[model samples]
Target: MSSDLFYALTGASLFTLGLYALIKHAHILRKILAINVMGSGVFLLLVALAAGGQQAFDPVPHAMVITGIVVAISATALALALMLRLREASGLAVLPDTSPEELSEQLPEAPSDVASKNNGKNA
Candidate 1:
């Protein structure tokens, strides 16, 4: 196969794999990683297509890739920050809570010593 065709196939494979991972995983970090992978695949496809065109090399795709990189970095940073906040507030990373039992399972209980002390005073 031609070099361009090979690269295009590889890029398409990466994109498909990344999309699968993104959909299959529930964790925020995994989703973020999948997004990055998909972005890389898109960048690779753009570069490969740009290279396949006649003439030396187009600078437009390269510039677009650079801009995409910046946007991805910022988006990743924001996602991480939101994850941190969610963890701090709820003591868990995943969302929806699913069940009351699950939420109860994650919570910290009050100290037994303090409970006993209060009980003794009441008695």
Candidate 2:
């Protein structure tokens, strides 16, 4: 019935949805998006709690939310960079455990001359 309760419930619901999505999805990009959604939900809850029946707005939670936003952005950028690098190196977005032989099989074949040169030497 109250505004505070409404905002809190909304935030909790968003957090639950995001958490479920994060757990159910296997893709790295989806996981990142779910994490961002969860962060937004936490931010909403923080703001709602800070505004609880108060005439004057509190700045502490506001500052924390801002800091959280900056951290989320930085984390997202780092995760995206790592994802790109992984894709380039493995030609796949998702990582899976595979033996060295399996990995080598996925890679492009070496030049015949290079293969021959290495054939006479011990690994």
- For this target, which candidate reaches the highest lDDT against the unseen true structure? 2
Candidate 1 lDDT over 13-116, as tens digits, reads 99999999888886778888999999989998998888884669899999999999999999999999999987655455655325635545554463244444
Runs off by more than 4 Å, candidate 2: 95-123
lDDT of each: 0.79, 0.79
Q: Best by TM-score, which number?
A: 1
User: What does each candidate score in C-alpha RMSD?
Assistant: 6.8, 6.0
Residue 11 accuracy (lDDT) in model 1 = 87
TM-score of each: 0.76, 0.74
C-alpha lDDT of residue 91 in model 1: 52
Candidate 1, residue 20: the lDDT equals: 99
TM-score of 2: 0.74
